[model samples]
Target: MGMTRLLRQPFSHPALPSVSFASRTIIVTGANVGLGHAAAAHFVRLGATRVIATCRSESKCAATLAGIEEAAGRKGVVQVWELDYSSYASVQAFCARADAELDRLDAVVLNAGVATRIYEVAEEDESSLTVNVVSTTLLAALLLPVLRRSADRFSSENNLTVISSEVHQWAKFPERDEANIFGSMSDPKTKTMAERYPASKLLQVFAIREIAARTHDSTPFVTVNMVSPGLNKTSLTRSTKGLEAAVIKIVNALLAWEPDVGARTLVHGVVAGRASHGVLLDHCELENDALAPWIETDEGRRLQRKVWAELERKLEAIRPGCVAAMEGKEA
Candidate 1:
């Protein structure tokens, strides 16, 4: 099928007949608001059997769940799962619960992330590397067994789609300094939030490729792809100040699509026509030549491997049993 045809098939819009999800299950992280919430609601409307809308707090997730249920005319079909991406224990706990309760997870939307106002270290010296990189990496690793089991139980084709950003093009990898990455910076030029945010996202793209490379030989049906939503008016962008906010607001008003529109590309990445096992996509299609430089770089790959190694060390320190458990299961 053509790319456009595949991308448009799963989501036809509210006026059209919703897609059937009689047996499919989906998990969307950070579903409490913004893109995650929109994606979860869309999945529910499409008739997904179960849509796990995960958030760090149950109370914060209430409104999102209520709105989705109201729109879908169902209650139990859409449930809440508490997941704090910053905490390794929380990530493990959520994965364990999912393994026990859910029959299978057809799709996992790795959408949760943090764009901090200031550089802050996590449990380790990992700042952006921790929340954006390590947390996501560990979550995917922890859930891989369940994802594989689900793929086996449910047909064969399963999907893992991570939400990356177009801004990743501006950052340099491999040369990142852990001290500067999470260090205290008083200078505006040295501590720009956009730079840090994009760097973390770049890491995610490489991680996606690494994951695809590792899994492709054994699991051809489990497609791993990265999705860039473009610039949408989500909570992530709501805090911009001065001319920056004004410029973004105007641009978003003129060209920025809705959260649902942005999410269309992500959903398509998961269920669309054949996507390259390790490709990075923007707005439902592979990014053009202009965006290729950011994703394809020896430096990027080196940085990704380094980040993975550092993450493994940190996880081994905090969650001693997790790495061993995941390795044994995948073995």
Candidate 2:
């Protein structure tokens, strides 16, 4: 994002319309706190029939639900489920439960993600890449049938939104040229944390664009989109320390939107019409321009297809038959 846009975000975004979600069932990952927590509460306050809030720990459920209910001034609508994006097994298990249990799944906000300056590995890859790109897309794929079924069954507009970031525009993504893009990303010897989070978000944009295009039909069923909630005051920077944390704090204080305000962008993504399909929703509207300029170039398109292929291969290795099953429904 440009300096002008970043500084204007907290001040210029207008109030979102109060749209009711009555009779809708929604899911939000990373709902224990931050934008996810606030978004879950907003769904409840808007009269959603149920909000399946997912966190990394079961122990956090009670307090998380309590806080959401308290914030909404409503209770019993939000239920916290356990999910660990670091584990493919956890992501699959959560989707399995959603498939088996929910009668009507209205929307899913894949908000669970991490931001770190450390070079830690999780699920056999760089931690941020695994959680933010691989597992997030995996969960989105695994939930496809459930969202489609809900649309077919209830004749409703069901959506799946992955929380993205405007920071993606800043990612140079030098690894895009590597023969094995993900392999290059996972290499600690070449990996750099300075742009890791932004690159991961860029990968998300690539994956979602491909997923949305592949899933598109004359009459679409489940609406799929990504949202950049703008810069928000969240614990996403909790891992940074000392001078880095201090700098971030100062920047956020000057520019970050309140979590609830930022989360309205997520809620807007869900309610956004089929027009939002295969696109980035920013500031509560379809934002094709928010994408990096290179994304429209020929090389960027090729890399997007490559990223989707690699991501599908990774998900299939983690859970056999999943990619094929999701593809079977595309046409």
Best by TM-score: 2
Stretches of candidate 2 exceeding 4 Å from the true structure: 218-220, 328-331
Q: TM-score of every model? A: 0.83, 0.96
Off by over 4 Å in 1: 1-19, 177-194, 287-291, 318-331
| Candidate with best lDDT | 2
lDDT (0 to 1) per candidate: 0.69, 0.87
**Tens-digit lDDT track for model 1 on 1-331?**
2335324534433233345656789999988877888788778877788999898987777887897787667778888889988777788899889889988788888898877556565655445667787788777776766777887776657777788776677675434655433332223446555567776777676666666766665443577777776666677855557898798677667655577766666676667544546776765666443144734577656666765566566566766655554443332
lDDT of 2 by residue, 84-115 (tens): 99998898899999999999899999998999
User: What C-alpha lDDT does candidate 2 achieve relative to the native structure?
Assistant: 0.87
The TM-score measured for candidate 2 stands at: 0.96
When summed lDDT is taken over every stretch of 10 residues in candidate 1, the lowest stretch is 179-188
